[model samples]
Target: MNEKRRFRQRLKDFDLTLPESKKEYNRMLFTPVAQVYSGITRVLSFGRDAAWKRKLISLLPEIPEPRILDLACGPGDLSFLLALRYPSARIEGIDLNTDMLDRAASNLARMPGNIQERIHFFPGDMNELPFNDGEFDIVSGGYALRNSPDLGRSLAEVHRMLKPGGYAAFLDFSRSSRKHTGRLQLGLLSFWGRLWGRVYHGNPEVYGYIAESLKSFPDQAEFLRLLEGFGFSPVHYLPRMFGMLRITVIRKN
Candidate 1:
């Protein structure tokens, strides 16, 4: 089969609602677009991608000699940012996508030795992390939660990996509370994603997964409740781009 047909078949065969299927689907979906993911994200967000990420990093509280994990750390943007923000901190990034990890490695090589020494990127899944319990001071992910095959399990892992009072910050597309508004946001995102997907990859479905994923994601209230259930307390909540995107910071109790 051709590239497009193969991708379509993968999309058809995998059901996003199932945890394992979503994991496999994401691997297939991201491999082809990993190289252009960062650039395309900037375009799709109308140049707000970097600013949103910077804000997510800024929301994190200060910690002395912190150990940080950037989950779903595609291209290591958040990881590198965390290193810069906390020079004394040790940063590790984990992602399931090997192609994205290669891109992150390339990005890491261009940094100065001091920064390079403090940051590491590896292959791992959020639902099943390899770290010890209470191993990190802070955890951050950009556009992370929505992509999780199992959101609650991933949040549980984050809570498990964080020390008492440690913070977990996430930036992702949010579903609005109002039904009409939610539908509008989904439509806009789907159109924008597909437009860029076709432009860059010659397949509209390449990025259309964003809206599909968001459909199953909980809105702000339910999201906060999930955090509470996982023994996290909300620290800060900021909505951006008319509530289509949100940055949430929570502390593990």
Candidate 2:
């Protein structure tokens, strides 16, 4: 086998590099190569990532005016959009990656006073959110849930942090339940992920964790059950990108 093939084989056997934890995952992708995350999102979402984010933002209750929490708000892509959509709402974000938070702050600082004033970020853990109980009206996570180290507790924290009738809207990958289709999807995504990673970061494995992580992510039905078990009532979700991704909108009981 060629050197590149051998290298990947070795990595497959031992690297096990994945954003699957509180510390290891936090430190894995926030390197310089992570600058391409937004672009990769755009391409993979068919230039509709922004629109999808907007849609996720819309899933929240807007009338009473929300105290918004954007968990794992990397680079503020969705947070910034939330600010534009809810100029007066209080939008706070918490993340573990300082580099991503720096980027998020820089982007937030560029907005007009009306928007910039309402958005902020800090270091936090999903299993133990820094906020008090029932502290928010709407909680939105952009591609954050699946990456969580503890999905149960991460969601439990969401339930704890939101007021009764509060909404939780999130976007993330959805592993197809159909075994054959999932394999095909994973193959295509792996090829595309490696290509994008190599072209943008000079590291073919930069985004390979996406495919690896999806392999273990719960299928949609199971995920919905998990959310329900957490007492998030009236849960609803919509698949995006031909079911490659999904948006869940659930209300705290």
> Per-residue alpha-carbon lDDT of model 2 for 164-189, expressed as tens digits?
89988898878677888778878877
TM-scores, each model vs. reference: 0.98, 0.88
Candidate topping lDDT? 1
lDDT of 1 at 109: 99
lDDT, model 2: 0.77
List the RMSD of every prediction in angstroms: 0.9, 3.6
Put down candidate 1 lDDT per residue, 1-253, tens digits, no spaces. 8968777776778888889999998887889879898889889889999999899888887789999999999899999889989999999999899999999999999999999999989999999999999999999998888999999899989999999999998999998878999999999989988888888988888888888889999987888888999999999999998898999999999
Q: Which stretches of candidate 1 lie over 4 Å from their true place?
A: none
